[model samples]
Target: MGRQRTKPAPTPPTTTRGRRTRDGLILAGREILEQRGWSAFTPEAVAQTAGVSYGTFYTYFESRDDLLHHVVRSVAGEMLAASLVSPDGVDDPYARLVESNRLYLRAWDRASKVLRLVDQGAAADEALRQIVHEIRDFYVGRATKGLRRLQDAGLANPDLDPRLTALALGSMVEQVAHARSAMEEPYDEDTVVDHLSRLWASAIGLQGAPDEGWAARARATAGTASD
Candidate 1:
C-alpha cells in the first residue's frame, strides 16, 4: 500500500521590518540618482548607502538596472505630479499656467541630476526612451487641453492650432528647464517664470491672444454660482 503524502506548510509572510529594509534600499538608490548621477551608481553602493545586506537588497530588486528603472520612474512621477497641479486652482487659468511652469522649474532644480541621467539613458535604451517620451507626452496633452480652454474662453487665438502650439510650448519649457540645470549660476525663480511666461504670451501674441477683459469675464462667469 502506498503511504499518503502530506503537503508542506506555506512559507511565512514577509515581516514589517523586512519590508522597511527593502524600502530603505530603494530610498538609498533614489538618493544616489539625485546626488551622484546614474554614471556612478551600483547595487553594492546602494546596499552600502542603505546600510542593508546585499542579499536583502536582492530580495527586493533583481539588479542595479532594476533599481535604476524604479528610481527613474519614481522621479519622473514626482515631476509629473508637480507639473500637473495648478497652484492657483481654477480661478485664473493664466495664473494656473504660470504657476505650473514655476513648479516645473523648481522640480527640475531638485531633480536635475536624475533628469539628466534619464535623458542620456533614453538615447540608448528603448524602454527608458519610451518612459521619457511618455512623461513629455503627458505634459503636452495637458498644455493642449489648456490651450483649447483658452481658445474656448477667447483667451487664445481661435485660428491658432492648439496641438502644434502646445507641443512647441511644452518642448520649449522642458528644454529651458533642462538647460537651467547646466548653468553654473542658477537663474532666479522669478526670472525663469517671467521668461517662460513672456515666451508663451508672445507666442500667442495679444493681437490674437486673450486680453485682461477676456480673463476678467471668464473669472466672473466662472465664479458665478451654478443654479
Candidate 2:
C-alpha cells in the first residue's frame, strides 16, 4: 500500500513581536503626520522612525494609503470615544446638550491636526472619503437620538425633523470646530462653548431659560480633563 501523504503545517499566527512592530509603525506614522504634516509623511520615514526595516512596513500595510487609513480610523475612534457622554444625572435637556457639545469640541481640538489631514485625504481618495462619511454618520446618529429624546420629553421642537436637524447641526459644529481649532488667533474655549450651546438650545426649542453657568461648568470640566 502507498504511504499516506502528510498534511502541511498551518501557517503561524502573528506573534507579539509582529504586533508590536505594527503598532510601532502606526505610532511613528502618527507622529510624523502631527509634526511634519501629510506632505512629509512617507512609508520610509515611518519605518525609520519606528526602528523597523522597510520590508516590515510592507508586512503590515499594503501601501502608504493603507497605513494612512489605519491612522485615520484610529484617530476617529478616539474622537468617537471622547464624544460619548452620559446624561443620566443632568436633569436639564439644554444643560445635557451643552455638556455633549463641550465634549465634542474637546475631542475635535485634541485630534484637529489628524482630522484636517483626513479631510484633505478624503477629498482626494474615495476610500478615505467613505471613512469620513462613516464618522459623520456616527455623529449624526447620536444627534438624532438625542434630539428624539428631547422631543419625546417636550423639550425639543415637535415640528422639526430629528434626522435633518441632526445633519445640519453636525455639519455646522464640525466646520466651526475645524476652523476654530486651526485659527492662529487665540480664542476662548468657554465663549465658543457658550455660543454653540445657546444656539443648539434655541434651535431645538429647549424649555426654560438657558443656564448661564453652563460655560463655567464646561471650562471646569475641560480643565480637569487637561490635568
Candidate 3:
C-alpha cells in the first residue's frame, strides 16, 4: 500500500519581485494560449517563455488548467468590461444595445484569434469546453439582466422571453464578432454595430412595430373590407 503524493500549496506573491515574476508567467501563458492553443499551452512552455525554471511555474499556479483559467478569465473580463450594458445604467434600451455591441465588437476583434482558438479548442478538449461554456453563461446572464430591466420598464415586448432573447441576441453578436472579416465586403465598426443593435432592439419590440400592433390591425382591416 502506498500514499499518493501531491504538489505543495503555491506561495502567494507578496513582494514586488514576486509579483513581477507571477505577472510575467500570466502574460506568457496568455500569449502561448493565443498563439498555439490547447496542445501547446503547457506550464513548461509558459515558464520557459517567462524565462523561469519549470519548478518556478508551480509556485504561482496549481496546474496547467489553473493558468489557462486565469488567462481566459482575464480575456473575458476585458471583453465584458468594455461593454456598458449594466441593468442599472440610465441609457435607453436601444442606446445600451448600440454601445454594448460596439465595445464588445472592438474587444472581440482584438482577441479574435484567441476566441476563435477557444471555439476550436473547446471542441477538442473537455476542460476548455467547460471554460468556454462558463464564460458564455456569464455573458448571457448579464444580457438577460439588462433585458429584464427593459421588460419591467415596459420597453420590451410583453410576450418575448428575456433570457431566451438575451441568449439569441448575444449569440448574434458573437457570430458577428467572429465572421465580420469573412464577409465579401467587410463593414466598418459603426455600420455593423448599428445594424446588429437595431436587430436586437427589433427582436424585443423595442424599436420595431409589434406583430399585434397597428400594422397588423391595418392588414386585418383591409382583408375584412375586401371580403
**Lowest-lDDT window of 10 residues in candidate 1?**
1-10
Query: lDDT values of the candidates?
Result: 0.74, 0.81, 0.77
**Per-structure clash totals for the candidates:** 0, 0, 0
Q: What's the candidate order when arranged by decreasing lDDT?
A: 2, 3, 1
Q: lDDT at 183 for candidate 1?
A: 64
RMSD of each: 11.3, 11.3, 5.6
Best by TM-score: 2
Strongest candidate by lDDT? 2
What tens digits encode model 3's per-residue C-alpha lDDT throughout 1-227? 11222669787899999989988998898888777866788877898899998878888888886677677777777776766456676455566677788878888876776667667768877877887888788888988987888788887877888789889989988888778743534788998987888777777878432332656789999999999
Tens-digit lDDT string for candidate 1 (46-153): 988999765556666766776777777878888888666644476565666678888888888777787788888888888788888888888888888878888888
lDDT of 2 by residue, 1-227 (tens): 11222434323228998778777888888899999987777878898899987767777876677789888888889999998887565877777777888899999988888888888777779988998999999999989998898889887789999999999988888877977888753667788778888887777777763754566789999999999
lDDT of 2 at 103: 92
Give the Cα error of residue 19 in candidate 2, in Å: 2.3
Prediction 3 TM-score vs. true: 0.76
List candidate 1 stretches off by more than 4 Å: 1-19, 87-90, 206-227
